[model samples]
Target chain A: MKLNKTSRNFKILDAFYIAMMILPIIFGIVLQVLTKPVSEGIAITGARVYFTIPMPVQDFPITESQVNSAIVMVVIFFFCLYITHGMSKKIELKRQHLAEMIVEKVDSLVKENMGEYFMGFAPFIIAIMALSAFSSLLTLFGLYPPTSDINIVGGWAVLVFFLITYYKMKCGPINYLKGFAEPVALLAPINFISEFATPVSMAFRHYGNVLSGSVISVLLGSALAGLSSMVLGNLPGFLADVPLFQMGIPAVLSIYFDVFSGCLQAFIFAMLTMMYVGGAFDLETYKQKKARKSAKNKQ
Target chain B: MELAIGIILGCCALGTGIAMIAGVGPGIGEGNAVASACEAIARQPESKSSVTTTMLMGCAIAETTGLYALVIAILLIFVAPGLLVDLLVNTMNGLK
Candidate 1:
């Protein structure tokens, strides 16, 4: 019957959303009318080097991924700072509620997945999750997503791998080594190599999903541009360069790829990290094994 | 010699196509996983969240093989053809 402030704000957001969808197509048509048709080759190239510093062994080259990642991290830093600034003992403000919500969500996620003993890892997991989700979501702003770079995802996977190995080694060095030869000595080499597969698989899984999404987007965009040019060849310059299809479709695909998959991958990465690291310290199984060993020692 | 280069390029394309056959394993495996997940969720509606989470995780893990094949195909299509062509050209020039 009556409009509230929050509902009014939502109505404004709906208008903005509709404008975003329509403005692009209108702008594309206008741009086509103005500029010459330029059909660029579509290739899925890696991060570009912005500049290089000369070195004797190997020149240090700064890349798109590096600069964008640094920017993303800085943005995240200021965001956290802004949210937590002017703190009070009681949560009196919306920003305080937001800050508490973020921390509480991440805390509950880590506690549920990794158990209370690994509460120390909550901050680390939150850092990984935030950096990953933010980096993947960077693509919507027209930046080269860091997650598409294998090196970025690989570095995170390697760090998680280190944590996994660290937890495994807590059982004892001899026991850890002996784990590689479990069931039969002949399987030791395979078991040893398979352990390393964890990080490699994790890296490739995240990188491939992110990269594939961008690759498909690029391919679709260029294909639409070409198709538009071909079909509208008989028409004047405006119609020929319209890029009609891309304006209609890419917005939808980007929502699925950038928002859905980006968040999904980030959650999956964090979940896998928790599962692998937590599986290492199966307190019930470890306790039972220890008890059995102590009984044997007593006998 | 030109024909040989064409054949090499063609074969690379074929190999890339063949590499995608790796997708079959994961597709079937993930389908079965989702099917079972749906059954589990239907049997116990309250377990839907946990079941969905587990199914998605399994699907993602299962997807790695297909993703590896896709990566190899990309390399074959983009990298191998150019590298092989360039090497052949240089080798022919040296022979000349």
Candidate 2:
């Protein structure tokens, strides 16, 4: 088939759109450094508690700083989603044919095969991809990965839980809540607690891993540089005396610190989030119901 | 010499801290996966198992980059040849 001018133009436009999206991120880094100059260290300096509820029982005091993390996480999620939503909408309007084509393809594969629930899931998937790209890019430049922050993760968990609860309620609150009691009401609280715990754990797991990885990166780099120097000084010969070799030696480790762990942690965080959300909806019940219908048909 | 060594080590630590800034990718990517996956399960309410599997697979793939960084950092710290050379050199110097 002959290549159409329109098709070629559309390709060019797509490239431009991607560049536009990335422009701000790049600019922000430059501006951020020139003006505010935020230090690129993975350290939690302080905490800001969000709310304080009076408790009759004595316990650790609740401070606004405590919930600050949750708030930050929520904000990051909101910010990422907001950007992705805006971009998708703009793309849809600007390149309707391409957008429709993409949507249709996804719908057939996701909604048709996975079920109708996967219909609107594309937006979220795109959003996650964008955020992952942004997070990974930021890590390369030595900035705090917002996703690695507990507050951000907690915020995400909270958002996920709220969405799940909202859907469950919309479907039928009474029936939905009853689902938790399934096979036993005594198990309801356990189920209920698990649902809420999903986000908390999801958020923390990412935060803990990324944060720990960062610390390790710092410790490793330092130890290597130190070792290289001490070795070169004592040897005092061409075999041992080379500063270029010293720094070059550690660059291998740098690749790992900068590339692999950064992306892996992001993927893990996203996977866990997907798994938790999937569990909240439950798959076993549907299978059992389907099996019952099939058995009855056979009889 | 000790002061220089201290400063150099400090700078390396600083460089490491700088390197880790790239970690933001996996965190947000994973979080978005979780949120979207939850939304999918919410609507379909049927293909939960299949959906979960796909999501886990996707997340694992995303995590590959981050894991590379982690491994490199670990090698640098715990199993670096350069570090072993340094340790040996320092010990030999001390004996003299």
Candidate 3:
């Protein structure tokens, strides 16, 4: 192939290569000098407490997760506002189209998964999905994501557990009680314990995935810092301390752990909620009971 | 006394390592699930999306056991040893 030696594209490519070599070293040294690592060493820790409130009976400590959750809630509040701001019979803007698409998709997903009669559960399911997916993505902003906190995810899991129980009981109180002794009377205790295990497992799964991701990120970051100093230790004053190796390398791992895993866990949590709650009741029995109650009112 | 404390920490480190062995089962299980999904997709490319989504849900369920193991290991690493050592020291001082 013939080369275009003097073209504008060629010149630009040449300049990019030249800058790529010289820029990182100069910038890395400057950045290193100007800043320090957020935390000194690598160890897994709980959310830091910001303050304590002296209540009547005990002290209420406000944590990083609490603050971050408030921020996330404000963000979601504004997002809902923006999505609902324009009211028109026709969809003209891309924003309106996108909002309409999201609602329609969520509605269909619920109807498909939970069947037609449970259409009213759409808003609850959507709220859970939005809160989970958005809070999980908070890690990208360097915020302490609330979903990573066991208490936060545990609360949501408990809500799901309650919904599951409510739907199960709606069919028949007797069958709901009998579900504990499923298959045999001897296994009642085991079955009862398993009922409680569902929510605990759900909570832990989301929290563990996020926690492990952050732990790995911190360990990788500290290791890179150590490795960079070892290799570049011989550099002139102020350059030895620079994290020369951590510039672009960790982004590869971040994309998977923070973005991909975060979103996947959120989706998995929502799917499990829909499956468990939707399948809890016998649809025929539930409908029959509702019909009987309504027919009595007509009489 | 120092030896006992040292041994507690050492054993916790070992326990954490062993707890992570639970990760092995899920890895193998998910691999098998994905392999089967791939074969199914190759046979019928038109059903790729459904196949992948089903596979993902199955994999996440399979991952529950490993996630439980991770939580257990973290507790062992970060919470158990320190609390155990503190209890030991307190009892020793009380005996004095």
For DockQ, the strongest prediction is 1
Model 1 steric clash pairs: none
Q: Which stretches in model 2 have alpha-carbon errors above 4 Å?
A: A1-22, A35-114, A234-299, B1-96
Q: Quality of candidate 1's docking, in CAPRI categories?
A: medium
Worst 10 residues of 3 chain A by lDDT: A28-37
Taking the tens digit of each residue's C-alpha lDDT, what string does model 1 give over A1-299? Answer: 22342366755754555555445434433533444235467667788776799999999988767766776676666667656754578554477888888889888888888898898988888888888998898887676788999888999999989998988887778778887888899999998898999999999999988988998898888888788778877797577667767676888999999999998999899999999999877577567878989999999
Residues A58-161 of candidate 3: C-alpha lDDT, one tens digit per residue: 99998767766766666666576555544356654456777788789889988888989888988888888888878878777666678889999999999999
Candidate 2 lDDT over residue span B1-96, tens digit each? 456556546555555555555567877888899889999999998989778867876666555456455534444443454464577568768999
lDDT string for model 2 (A80-155, tens) is 3333332443344334554466556645544443355545665664455445435544655544555555565567
TM-score of every candidate relative to the true structure: 0.83, 0.50, 0.87
Stretches of model 3 off by over 4 angstroms after superposition: A1-39, A56-58, A291-299
User: What tens digits encode model 1's per-residue C-alpha lDDT throughout B9-72?
Assistant: 9999999999989989999999999999999999999999989989999999999999999889
lDDT of 2 at B2: 59
* Error at A105, model 2, angstroms: 8.6
Q: Where does candidate 3 clash, by residue pair?
A: none
Computed on alpha carbons, the lDDT of every model, listed in order, comes to 0.83, 0.56, 0.83
